[model samples]
Target: MVQHCAGLPLAIVVLGGILATKNNSLNEWRKISDNVKSYLKKSKNQRPDDVLASSIASSKQKERDGGEIAEDVAESYLMELVESSNIRSLLFFNEFFPEEALEKSLPLEVLNYVKEHEDEVCNPLVCIFMISRAGTSCLKARGIWRYMFNNFKLLRALNYEITRGDHSVGFKLPSDIGNLIHLRFLSLKDLKFSWIKLPSSLGNLRCLQTLDLRVGNYEIHVLNVIWRMEQLRHLYLPFMCKSRTKLMLGTLRKLLTLVNFNTKNYYLKDLINMTNLRELGINFPFNFENFNEKELGENPFIIRSKYLHSLSIITQWLILSIDPRHLAHLLSSCTSICKLSINYARISKLPEYHYFSSHLAYIRLLGCEFKEDPIRTLEKLPNLRILEFESSFEGKEMFCSAQGFPKLESLILGAYYNLEEWKMDEGAMPSL
Candidate 1:
């Protein structure tokens, strides 16, 4: 049955199992054999086993040193189709080539086949091209980018990372990148380019959802173009040409994740406009000495983010001390917040009259000082399940006693330099 199935190893194995069944009979066997034979004859003017062997042979040829046998056979088949006679490229052969061997080596014959059959290639499959080098010299190789971009149009993703080596040379992206309108994800990391001006045609990629560009030294003007992509969901901007620029929240309302906003002297008001933002990480300037408790209370950035669920601020103590009123307002706005992390440089007294988040399930405080009455403030958080305090100083007699946490389940305290004892209620101790 395997032989009759034109060497289709999978079909042969499956049929062998069926033949071993008790219900299998001579008539059933005959029917299966006849169907396999018919399928082979219809596929080509050869036995099914012979056709499968030919396919294997062609695949092997393409895999081994980009041999010409596969290309010749594939080209012949295409020419005979007459209907697709104009199609010259043998990309199909390239697709069938073994992937493992192709990574460390490129077959010249395969390249030649693709070039010669370029006109014949009618339908191209989605392909990913990745280039990464440790040093800069390798990135300067000529014609590499052009050759790849010109030949590959159905690219779904492109990731290129290169570092500097000898001379300060910059790399350039292929000019025809716009042709790959189907691109969904693009990542250019550590590229040596000094100034990258995105092609306006980038907006044509209506399907693009992610664009990541990271360079050590570059004037990135492509952000304006990226902002036009309505489908964009994730954006990472470690550095940009313009400093002290305010991002329009309306333009990035669709963004769900943003990172590396490491800018100097920027206002939080710029982010307040992003109504749909779910996760945000930014470094705001800190001036502990000049901080005004009243001015911090008026900060509009904290008042506008009504839909925020997870927040990580530079310092919880600074914000709380600078403006406890603003902190209270910010906490009140985020009723849906589930996770909160605050890093304070120094310990500050907690507000006397404060409301805890009803939805908060996880909280982490680092490098902060907690008073002896730490549990008193935490008692307001009815839903807190996990709490972590790292490298923090808490007053003595700070124990998980009955009056402290009634519903807290997980507690982790590290480097509690001043912690002496933990208090827990007689019967309200959490089931840890």
Candidate 2:
């Protein structure tokens, strides 16, 4: 029967459901097994792919435009047939598949299967850790969960893409997750809860290397535990406003990448301690202190991060307190930045005709209004290979200088609804 299921989890679930409805008599199960064996033997010559494709198409139609199917039909049918069924036997029979079957299936398939029938298989899904693979894992839960932390002990990575059911207003995860001693990578994405409170035991994941969470839209708080994940190499989260907890960042010496860093929660001194950082993404708050040329020169984090390669800044547009020239000076401090992306910034002018970062090779600007010809300054980047401008400038005419963008390979000028004249000088972009 396991072979007949062909290592497909969905097929196994359906077959298990069918058996769950039958009486727990040896003869009953034997008859069903015999019938399945006989059918497989007789149909050995049939194309399984063709049959499976047909079955998938039929299932899709009944599922209605790829949306959730009604579970009432499945539940009512199971209840009618197994009103007196033994739950223990059902649990026992569910593990008929070989251990290798669980390991071979992709994590995405397991997540989908569990989410599809969460109403029916939620308990079994966690009780049998067969759903999670050893190295990398993903699970999506809609309601309160208790056993997942206990079962996912050996995982090296876990991405919890959790959602809230209609009745669920707040979400909380078990502190036992700290027991996953081998965990290294963790992420939480697309969470929809009024407030998410992380357990203090989160500080116990000493081996955690990567922490990624999309916590901007929700009121996610109490994340001081992050300071304990000392080995974190990559951190992806939006600015957390109104936090008094200070990070013991010197312990996180291995940190190399940060995404959407909030200046409000941290200070330049804190960033200076992470001197090994490479790639960074920051949302420059409107109230951020302006840095003078002397201060920018003294900030070792920005001036001495020789490994810094990619930088993304999403500027706050509601207030324009800092002069645009000072912004250029701050970027120039990152002498090694190669790729830069700026969004929603209100820089009205470029400082001079010289490129800000000597090693900058790629640039992407979005929703920034430039008061003058940006090309005059951008065309001077010696190592620039790709330039993309999206709804960034209001100028209708742009002129490129002779022998400009010496090494540029690609240029994408998109969403410039007002651009009318683009004039290139003789020998302009000669290497293009």
Candidate 3:
């Protein structure tokens, strides 16, 4: 039944999933094949939705026979679908939240909704929680969040970010948040508040798969319960933590995108466990468990993740602590990375061309204060196409040799205040 609609993505996914489950077990594969054949013989007009439903029902029957572990395996199938680049980005318009009711149900649809309906029962089906930027939203959001936690048990997605437009009181995350057991996605980013008190009950969200906790404030007390979210795939941590934030993440084999990872919150050696990671963002002033700041600045450990494709680095402005050697050693491990962003780093020149990834295509340098010609090594990046510099380099003149940037297409330079001349030879950037 699943394979009848052979060319369609729906059918392909259904068939591909069954193959993964069977995994070299011909007996299991034959059993599933027989089950699919039985379903197809009953349906006359083969439709995608009908075939899809039959496959799901068949999967459920197997889960019932195989016990509770099968249920976990079913969830893993869902994660596989989410991880697939082909299906992940496809937009399912209002699949959860109704388009017509969204205007009336969204908590912050109107700027005055929170103020007007402090005790209002928001539409229970509301999935996306985007509160207005109004500062007053923070005060009233407490009751709203609590209500949702207690009521919306099966809610799948939630996003909350209430800026402190004029309010001074901090937002307190309700401990009852653990009650949201079915929540798969949650984002609390850009809450422009003074402080955030994270509840320990947050560990109860075992089903959460995607979590973003990057608030604007620097003071965020993140409990070490994140290791419990074994299903987490994309995790965006805060830019900085309030106190010591230690987490054991060796079990998160499914994690793919990790942002704002620093040694203070995580063990640097634990990175090797996330072999499936594709995108990573880290903070600077490399302070690992055993390495002192001075030691790390002198000789940094070379990261080794073969699958990482994107890397974002943000160096703290604390006494200009980062060195070019530190970044050189770090980039050597991420040879597969395609996009690189270096922000507020202390390096005065670009790293050697050999340290850059072989797949590097785009680079954005901000506040690096490069005095030498930043293009010397960068222009040699064979795959580089887009290069952007924002107040990143300072010099009286810059040079680009002939045939240096063969694949370059876009070159952007901003805030080059002291630049006196830009010298590029013929064929320096043939693609531009």
Candidate 4:
């Protein structure tokens, strides 16, 4: 199923959602597959862009002969991908093209979408994407989104990236954005701005499933409206944002991938509700403020999901603020993690073997500088396959017990200049 969409996440969602409503008959599915192949394989020699370029040319010719003007066409094919009911998923692809070439035609096509479709008896739900091409002229992109917000109320996916050069110094999300009740995906990632704040009206996007708020070159303040998106699956906050940008997410019970989360803005208890979460990332300065190490052992903060396979805690060379026991109990809570990565944690010692996840297959530690030998402790992990250490030890002697690392396949040690003695028992690391 993943391979069929070329492993593109948006394509997977769009195709999967479309397929869910189809009949289970194999013959019927095979016929639909043939049409998909024909649509994608327009010609043996034509690349995807070539097919797109040809599509614009064909749409323009059709428009001249009295067909729909914005038949998912741009004045130049590279300018914009117009929305078509059948090919709604292709417009949001991250493609880079010059904005100067299609300056005149971009607005005309966008403004005409509502005029042509407003009177249609029963139009299918559609999606529209407005990718901000670098070097876009300021005058060429004005009033485009205003038109979209005023119209296109049935839009499902809207990926809009605006450049600092394209808009005025102050930019605000239009209140009408809340009217997009049917929207499933909304990505404003890579918007170059100074300071932008999400409006309270954004909570009206009750049906949104994917929301990306990553911004470039400036800070964005997200309001607490995300808690209203009860249907959200994948949520990405800004890579960097205002310090006190209080946002709540406890209601996202069905969330899958959560990125750029720091302990600063959100509460740890909120994680208890995301039972379906699979991937989670903690951004810089993962603060563990007001922690009690002794109490942590008695009552660990267990993340409820057993499906979480990857865990990452990345910081900017800052030492971990919590004690080693805090990390230990935290690791013990995640019993299903297969891979673990921590950088500059300053824990001084690795967690006890019993505290580590038994399912862990790979581990990487950087700059932790464990005061004690980690080999003896970590070697007991029954399913361990790979172990990596970089500047994580400051010892002159190291030892591996007999019959240790039974299933290990790869071992890497780096930047241990103080090592003067090394001992491995005869039967240790036999599988290395």
Candidate 5:
């Protein structure tokens, strides 16, 4: 039977041992029955039995005789094995069965066998865990989640991918997900949870360092909860709700190396508060009018950022009418900024009365209109190396004077509607 049931090696070993003990006598058969009964009567240590049952239960239905395993018999044997002792010991043998073994379809009876032994499938003591939907009709089958959530608590790294036939189906997360305090990494990608909201308790995963939640159209309201996790170093949230809501930016200020932030409507004050931020990317409309320019003007936007080296701002429109002096003051505050990008801005001309910084090395102007000579204004940068211009400009004459850029290295002139000629001295002609 061991060699014949090629798919279930562990079950074959255990059941074959019992069969060998029975020899070929009715007395041995009676002993085997009694032993199985006693094994079931023992404590809830049937992890091995549950694993064996799931392995055997998932075996291809087609038998050696070209017939499928009878659903009733498969289910009955699985139930009997699950009720046996030494179930918890099965968690140690993840290599016993090949991954392909669970790919085959099983009978409904085999599914019922798994459903009955669900508790044994996931043992908190076992480092190796398995959850199979091969025979189960629904994910909500009794004891299914209990086994999963309980076992998840002990996992150091978890990769759970469950497939429901229907696209509209949404899986509900167990409320006790926070119990996985030991989890350091978690990945949930290409999943459908449109109807379910992430539990706030997930914030309790204090030890988690990496979390990737890249599901589509799933609305998550746990930003506040996520903000409280001080130990989190990397978070990948590619998709989120567009509805405006106040985010807890102040909570993330403590992260010294926070490199990426792909969110919208985030309070600028909260972002400005993160003194240690490096690379930052934000996509959403911001109402500059709401910024407390008067009170916060004492400490301008750039002044608070001592470590900020790169900044990118994208929105529908940029308010150019902002007090140029205030804008210049804010720009001068960032003593360390090396790269800056502004998209859809209204400011066409650079302010003449402003004090410029020497650290500004690169500037990218996208979809913006200028009222004054942009090139002449950009000429103030003694250290400017690269400049990119995109979209047509209302001004016709381009500023290419020697005094404009003494140290300029690369100049990309693009999409200027009525550009006639670049005015520059022969000595100031850039090598490019």
Candidate 6:
């Protein structure tokens, strides 16, 4: 009996279940052993689980007046079990696994597999979470998402993380996706140099709160219909050249976080009414030579909301410059900003503002060459907790005075090739 079950735990458990339900007659035991052996002989190349499944199916058929079950009918039943088990596994697994790990592996496989067996899989249309990775997964097949969207009307979130290595096989979003009014969160990341075609129908997702599209090197086309998504709370998109169309975004009063957006054709005034905004990320386009810094600083478009706490600016080109005076205006505009990140901009001197916001706690500077010592200007921030410098500042010496950065906890300085000297006074960065 042990040899017939091959000593596998799952097989033993299933056989035990079968034995528990049947009469303990020698004839019944012999019949079950023979059936298992016959199925094992037929499924030699398949997994042991497959053989067990076949044996169970044959036993059930024999019990039902010895009628044969159609292959399609049998497959449908097995698939139903698999679908239910997989969904439960995902829901349980998500509690322990990190979001990035879940995003890259299991969830993506489940979506594609369910989509492939759409007709046979039970409840295939209900997707609570879906993820598609690059190259390795079958979801990369062109228009697969579009076809799948027709089935997934109740989808809540969809994430796509494609590698930039294979630009030729980029995915597309069908206009039909807009029909999924229940969708609340969506993300499209890492489509380098690939063009993403957005449909005007995307604006129909009024229930959407999070839209993340921070592809490393790609251009996303937007339609004016985007401004109509009144329920948006977080918006993340790529920065491209100026669009001819205008977008009035201030009406999205519920918005809390905005990231990596282009402000080329749209005036800063369009965002002044977004009173609930807390975090802002801007990736300035390359054609900012014509943008007037003085005019922008004085413009009523300045963000004065107390809810605004984080600000980030990204620049790709070398010619794009941010003046010290303009920097001061930005700092003054958002007095409550706690976190600030400036990247790839040319700022020769630190802003003249002697005292930064009292609430400011974190500062990250990258690729912004400085002619003056930034450490001197930054050390006085009373509530500063985290300071990071990457390939920024070329000063010869840095001194940390006593009582500097009283609440600071973390200090990270990297890629400063020319920094030769550092001095720290007693009690400097006491909490660091």
Residue 375 Cα positional deviation in candidate 4, in Å, after optimal superposition: 2.4
**Per-residue lDDT tens digits of candidate 2, residues 215-327?**
53644655666777787888776444345564445566656787767556655445656666788787766222535557655642343556678888785434233357556
Residue pairs clashing, model 3: none
How big is the positional error of residue 89 in model 2, measured in Å on the Cα after superposition?
A: 38
Error of 3 at 125 (Å): 17
Winner by lDDT between candidate 6 and candidate 2: 6
- lDDT string for model 3 (1-432, tens) is 455655767555656665674446554566556555533333445787876677577667754554223334466468547656676366655423444555575555343534465455453222123342323343435666666688778889877655434444556778888999888999987665544668889899998889999886475888888889998888998877765646777777667789888776677777767766778898854644455678666764445557678999885545254667657867877879999998887677877999898789899988888878888899889989998878987787888999798898998889988989989898789998
Candidate 1 per-residue lDDT, tens place, 1-432, comes to 576666676556655644554245554466446444433333434686787676665456543542323434455355335444366765533323444454436557445644554443331110112232223443433245545666677888876655334344665555567677778787776666644665566666666767776665545555345556666666666454453354333456556566544324333444555665666654333222223667555643342544456766563123332244444555565656778776663435444424455777788877656544555676557778788877656677764546555567998878876767776667553544
What TM-score would you give candidate 2 relative to the actual structure? 0.62
- By TM-score, the best candidate is 3
Return the lDDT, model 6, position 155: 91
Per-residue C-alpha lDDT of model 6 across residues 358-414, encoded as one tens digit per residue: 788899999888878887788888888999988888788888889777898998989
Arranged by lDDT, best first: 3, 4, 6, 2, 5, 1
- lDDT by candidate, in order shown: 0.55, 0.64, 0.71, 0.68, 0.55, 0.67
Model 2: lowest-lDDT 10 consecutive positions: 130-139
Per-structure clash totals for the candidates:
18, 0, 0, 0, 12, 1
TM-score of 4: 0.65
Model 4 residue runs over 4 Å out of place are: 1-142, 160-176, 243-246, 287-297, 317-320
Worst 10 residues of 5 by lDDT: 124-133
Clashing pairs in 6: 193-217
Q: Point out the higher-scoring one by TM-score: 4 or 6.
A: 4
Could you give candidate 5's per-residue lDDT for residues 10-38 as a string of tens digits?
55566666565433766455544533433
